[model samples]
Target: RSAGVSKAHDPRHAAKMFKSAQEDKTGRWLAIHFTSHDNPHISRDALEELIQDMSKQSYRQEILAEDDEIQLSWLVYRAFNERTNKIDDFEIPKNWLVYVGHDFGGANPAALFVAQDPATGNFYEFKEYLPGAGHSTAQHVDMFKELTTGYSVIWRSGGSHQEGEIRQGYSSHGWPIVEPKINSVKAQVDKVVGTMELNKVFIFKSLHNRLTEVMNCLWAPDAEGIPTDKIKDEEKYHLSACARYLYCNFTPDTVVHNKSRTSHSMSM
Candidate 1:
């Protein structure tokens, strides 16, 4: 007898059946539980593509054989490092350019504090804030002001849904702001992939909220089980949107000045 367990079947029931079969030692019995990651026939390139395209839940259940409530898998965890990238909190160098990326949704407004290393051109996301629901724009601005008191911050806004209102709110409080022309979603995602591949992005170890978003954001799947460019789990992607805006819009030449701290804007 042989048994296999998949997302289509109950793992608990499969375990019970396998245990019962094991007790009946009169006949040869084999039980196998496997996911896509378990298959020896898959090529390395194919596996990487599959992982890049699959949703988190799909990857966990179909590739790792683990049942995760979130159907989509994260797109970034494979590249992020807690030791090298995710470092301990430290004072950002005075010469480093600092910027804030904002995803402006009234229900769950998200912001990320990013700093660029002048010498290496690498970017570090050091802090994140997600104030959920019922918070006014003034309140959000106040919070940001408190966090970025001394730094000269160049604010980048994502999503045109409430762009005008958000800009006004920040501008009223004397926050310097700009809206970079939005690129195609695929282009933004590709930029992130390229940065990660080159090991140019980093995060502070204490920014758990942003890390969680990075680990949970997933691509939506079509009826034929193909991953689409559309992202699933909108509620969990606020911080990701902020990161994408900064990644797609801000570059070393554009945002970082040699020593004068001059600011420039460019669109990806």
Candidate 2:
């Protein structure tokens, strides 16, 4: 039986459920994937209670912990143990690809993408490419290439003409490219829903960091359900990358007004 393991008010109560599942012959291989929020402490009191409950069970089980830091650590751990092993440490759907940035060029613009798992209908933040404190676009591109040599990438030019400028710059380096066709907020959300539906994808809230920003950044105009302008007036490369993912991945049935009008237009 599948269950979302989290901090339970009563550990004893949760134990009973596990016990019942174990009795069923078909439920012996219980894979309890941890989708709950994990804090710094490896063994929190509440977490220990759940662990203890699982330990008591005689049936075979496995714990697949899923979280941001934990997932990253999992990648490293798997790589170390499975060096030379035929199996890959990480998995992403074939259709899904990385989304590249073309706004702030180097310092502030964020390069991000979503990898939707077709089987589970879940989207992982996949990876992000951010320019460092004093790095140029060329440097960031070089680093990005190094970081994502084998991974498929999807590029986006979303910031009016500025996006065009980013495109020209990255093109010099031969990055696999695509254009952001999303022209409106409604379209952006629609693209998200459609992409999820099209690819059987669900945004992995517990795993993806950008989801938090996406959820927080979106707002309504006067409660009529119309989207207001995106949050701006500062450097938000990472946040913008998330926004662009929503913009590019899904194509909506009804398009929202594309806010492609920005002061920093790329004339090329």
Candidate 3:
């Protein structure tokens, strides 16, 4: 759990249960997912043509497939691709509204820092922190402080699989975190998808880890084989979770009003 409770009342409780049941060796559930690619009833040329179409708009194909994308496919797909969202040589505004997002699940927890262009209401992810296990909470806090030394950080938000971890752990450790109000992972993920599609948010080229996880993040199909909010190989998607948390908690009213320093950029 990121910083919250790990129990049944969670929004994504069904997905967690699905994955768990699939892994159980006691024969309670036998998960089998198949696609048209594996269908013996289709002709070779028809299959090839279908595969070509699927490649062009894989997201829809995943949902339509008979197996319902059991293997899963890229979550953000081409929407968040480098051609659309990656920015090089982005200048950090001397004065801007700052927001930090966290994800405590998975082996590699993630912290994403975003600075909003106060005037434009656009957000730029300039940095990321993935301090793996073995580091103390104070150490992580110090690192977070060092990363955001100058900017005025206005919001800190995130979620976890366990109850109270988000509300209790970080607050106790000097970092107060408020969980997102909308609990549906789909809604949060849709915000990220829309942002990437609209190019409202961009990631600096230097943030390799952040870009990598999101680019590779895929939507996992539920037991019915339809792509769901559950992510595929979630343990590797700490940054994706961070991005989801950031966009879900963002509001237009949080823009900075600093007139002292103007927006500026320098060579990295």
Candidate 4:
């Protein structure tokens, strides 16, 4: 710990400290590693202000623009390679893990590996994977086997054929397959939104491709900013659809009501 370095506990406090540091002529550099969440929404001015404040208050160091980018394969390797930390443990009370995927057929199939902690109501991670990575059905089977060894998975499809393929290929291997609950565009969007409200839906840190696909899917130029029918990115629509399916299946209210009425009728 450097001198005059006190931990700023809150975001506002951290921002104030940055300002304090920038004012210090002795500060020549500012090296910051953000372990906290980064939102793309923060304004440039706000970011600049924080940076400038830190530089001015403390002995500013070089402002380095470096980000640690981890991939899904790497994350999986890491997660399974060693005992997961309490922070990353999939078994944590608040945590729920699932996979949402789409197939482009012959092209790299897209997927989002999602995990949410119901206890904390925070998303652990939503990541993307290539279903076609292994080449043959055996390869896909292996990938699916590895991908879904221990978590609940939600799969989304444009149709049922792929589901059949998955069932035949992987279900026998004991890969848990939840039926893909198909929904229209508005319904799908609503499902995603509703899930987010009910529980924290965090995209896995490693799955940038899947995250990007879902975000892109939401960006169509119709319905005046409302998400429209035209799914510009088929991959995105498919993955997001999977996400909606997960929400629809698990959330209590969304779960289909058991219509078979049970009567405690005493037969005469």
Candidate 5:
């Protein structure tokens, strides 16, 4: 009684199968199609993560539950909202923890500035700088210095092969960098998805490049109809890489503790 819409079994065929089942009249004919976002058991955060982990066609058919032509679909498409999540510039509280995440590549050297709100345990990406080709490491370093001049920040770098070079260059200029052991791609992606699902992540409206990259990042599906770890349209994944690094490595200083009275402490 279960059927999936695929190239071999199109929606028309699936519909025919449903009709045949309905004609049997032995049991109630019930059919439901929905994406993970529509599932009550999945939270918004989990759903977002699920989408990010899906391939282009998988997202279209599985998450969207739509019978349409499948093409490259965004991995983080469901995680962001321009109206609610994107905002105008705001001052970072002096007491808030600031973080800078870097993704280094010869073509694109990307950095993202994130501020954690201690009171709400939310993280906001307030700015991004993606300098495309022809920029030297020194130029990148200078830009980083100028961008983060006034803020006290914890600098974290993605484990690029060129990381040592980047570190040496920055350190020579007196910028301290920390390189945490990078987690598996799946792990980092899961963390980013979970964090966003809790409504704990935001972006600046003016960060058009970052937003565009997020919109374009998609998974390449394997032959088995599952999303492969391979990602596509990666010209902008650099900032996303920075985000993943920050979310995976940076621990918020604020922790919300729950208080409750034990049954033994209550009046019997």
Candidate 6:
């Protein structure tokens, strides 16, 4: 869709323009409106008209009513907006129990660091490591160690897609990584969804790479274009796999108030 050419559309030109937005995202001039039919500003007639028009294009994105112009066919994390919070200048107290979840990638390895608040039983993803390509396992271990220097990293684990050598590489280097206790993909997705619904998970805003993966985490589609349980673009969603590794490994027990625990709330 062009500025004034609704009937005559040029997709190639439109794609080129959109690609520019992706390249330099900081300064873009796109008038984005995120109002749904339930918006209070809409009159009854306007709402009815919007609904009627939406019914015609139910599966496609209603660009005028949403900010995400490209609607994900099957979004993986539905509770990402409501349950997750992002803060610019938040600090993790030294007392919080920290854990790292990792994914050994084909091109590059990635890790996500999460801290558990003993008092509220909430999990916060404070930092991430997703340096793309050419870095060795030893370097990744060193970077992770350096990142969580002061925090008490109780455990670190990941899924190497049954490639024992990759996990072995980390273990031999002294990181001592382990396989996830909850190994099933269904189990991992279920656990993440369950925890998110309970308001126990919050991902920091600083993790740009991780956040980008989360937004693009979509279920793979079948031959008939119906979304299936298998994830689409698995390579691009490596950090998302790290997220699945995270909640599966760190199952928070009932919040037993620790009097000595620092009051550094996971409140964004």
Q: Could you tell me every candidate's TM-score relative to the true structure? A: 0.66, 0.45, 0.63, 0.46, 0.63, 0.67
Better of 1 and 3 by TM-score: 1
With candidate 5 superimposed using the best TM-score fit, by how many Å does residue 194's alpha carbon deviate from the native? 1.4
- The candidate with the higher TM-score, 1 or 5, is 1
Name the lDDT of candidate 1: 0.66
| Separate clash counts for every candidate | 6, 11, 16, 35, 1, 0
**TM-score comparison, 1 vs 4, better candidate:** 1
lDDT of 1 at 149: 73
lDDT of 2: 0.43
lDDT of each: 0.66, 0.43, 0.66, 0.43, 0.65, 0.68
Query: How many steric clashes does model 2 contain?
Result: 11
**How would you encode candidate 2's per-residue C-alpha lDDT over 35-69 as one tens digit per residue?**
32335545567755666555321112223332222
Q: RMSD for all candidates, in order, please.
A: 11.0, 14.8, 14.2, 14.0, 14.4, 10.3
lDDT of 1 by residue, 19-78 (tens): 567676677776566777668898878889888877664676667865433232334334
Winning model by TM-score = 6
Task: Please identify model 4 stretches exceeding 4 Å from their true place.
Answer: 1-104, 121-123, 131-134, 148-166, 222-229, 235-238, 252-268
Worst 10 residues of 2 by lDDT: 74-83
Ranking by TM-score: 6, 1, 5, 3, 4, 2
What TM-score does model 3 achieve against the real structure?
0.63
lDDT of 3 by residue, 1-268 (tens): 3667564422233544566777899997886556665667878687676666443345344534422232224344446656556889566876877888888743566799988776666778998998877776667778888998877887777885454565576788877777764567777777677666655677898998876666556677555445666777766777777887777654323333443222222110
In model 1, which runs have C-alpha deviations exceeding 4 angstroms? 1-83, 251-268
> 185, model 5: CA deviation in Å?
1.7
